[model samples]
Target: MASGDLAVGVVCLSQTVVGLMGNVSLLYHYLFLYFTGCRPRSTDLIVVHLIIANFLSLLSRGVPQTMAAFGSTLFLNDIGCKLVFYVHRVGRGVSISTTCLLSVFQVITISPRNSRWGELKEKAPRYTGFAIFLCWLPYMLVNIICLMYITGKWGNTNSTIKKDLGYCSGEGNNEISVSLCVPMLSMPDVFCVGLMLWASSSMVFILFRHQQRVQHIHKNDLSPRSSPESRATHSILVLVSMFVSSYILSCLLQVCIVFMDNPNILAVNASALISVCFPTLCPFILMSRVSREPRLSFAWIKITKSPKPIINM
Candidate 1:
């Protein structure tokens, strides 16, 4: 790398790290406050889990790329390639699974008692951990092909397109090039999209139903601004909504990465921008939930200020 190129890389890397690290630190502090002092609710558990997921996502996807941006370019040298990529793949896979679990858990949590899903809702906390575990299964198993196919080889004009940052796979003259494309090209993206939709839809439906019931029950007595359940629901919904948006951006960016195969700095810039910023949003999403004060002040007072009930409606 030339001196100017190295200088630019350093600035880019420093900017990325500073932004993400600051947000991540805020996430940790809020998590500590919520876990140690705040009310012990199941929602707290899910948020905590989301934080963990975000941490791993940063470690897996963000760290390596950041390092490559500022540090040495030629990494994962023959053996290191598989190791770095393998660890990073597992991290990204865990991130995807965690988001899926987040959606499912919220759906189950908000389901009505009269609904058939009530039984499943009760099982949510117990199974949340297990569901997160289950999510890692496919990503890990299928990504074995990455280890087999990828190596530390530079791509001149002759190489397969890459999706992930600091992730060079099926590049250069590799034995697994022809072997891996069938599964890589079709299966993974389809599977992720399908599962993401299924999880998100179920959650949205349950939340919508819950909110409608709340509004109807309190009809014309709308003196109270909001309910605790409504506020909690809103928080989770926003968090999941952010996840959904990030996932869409990630998928599209990956597609773009594949489409712009040739060495164009514009493609590289857009792709890098997405890859670097993706995981960073996870921390911000969590922090956003914490910073937003509960909208249901009356509901909170119902429990906290039980001695005094001011009737207006």
Candidate 2:
């Protein structure tokens, strides 16, 4: 193997390992809380879902891609190809949906008593369970088309077009599938992105009002640590920004993967490297956010009481 390929393989391996460990640690932490009779907070449930999706995504996409990068060609079969791509897409969709739900849930949690969404805050726990459960339907349905067309390179042979030997390729005359599948796959994402942005905007407004109140009440005590709400607001904002940026970058790379007829190994390697960052970084980001406040930090709060109450609404 070339030094460059070895380097890429090393990076992919490291990312997959780190991401899996981080997410698994978080999962274990939450499950421990639940098993000990500590009632898991609604936000804990959401975090669990997010962690599951990211872990699966890393496994399906990162593991196989890493193996391939390291010169393993075992996944040249139709079933393996189908399974890898299917899991990756489904996990990606679930990750996006749960994130948007998280943003909306947090926004509702912080709603003013007089606000229309104030009533929603109380029922958010139930709604979160429902939302995360239902979010899989659209993504699952859309990716079903993948089983029909996506397969090993041999299955991609057609009279008009040739397929890449390096990656799974779909049927040649798949215009109908492309027309239907692309929109089905993307529509949920578009809607989720919109919802996340709307919630983030509302959060910004609330934070502004909160800041005004804080300044008026304690003008001399300008420390940011005085308010856990501000710390949470900052954390969520950072999470939202990171998720959006990573999601957009992945989408663009996928577009390139789809449109580029003669993609070189370098392009493929670059895409794989960039794609893993979101899942790899997400758990650490959550850890960092949870560390900001002691009372609400992950340290003192067991399963019973979450410091920030992310899903209170």
- Winning model by TM-score: 2
Regions of model 1 farther than 4 Å from truth: 1-49, 67-71, 153-170, 173-189, 214-223, 256-265, 291-313
TM-score of each: 0.69, 0.86
Candidate 2 TM-score, C-alpha based: 0.86
Q: Can you list the residue pairs that collide in candidate 2? A: 121-313
Per-candidate local distance difference test: 0.57, 0.75
Tens digits of per-residue lDDT for model 2 on 1-313? 8899889889999999999998887677666656655555567788888998998799987887788778875556788788888888888888888888888878877778789988886777877778888878888888877777667754445544443424565555456766787777788899999888998999999888877877766766666354655666667777788888888887886666565555567767777777678788888877765556353334345644645654677
Query: What does candidate 2 score in Cα RMSD to the true structure?
Result: 5.7
> What is the per-residue lDDT of model 1 for residues 16-92, given as tens digits with 9 covering 90 to 100?
57546855676666555553344445555545555555555555555555556555555545466676667656656
RMSD of every candidate to native, in Å, equals 7.7, 5.7
Any idea what lDDT model 1 has? 0.57
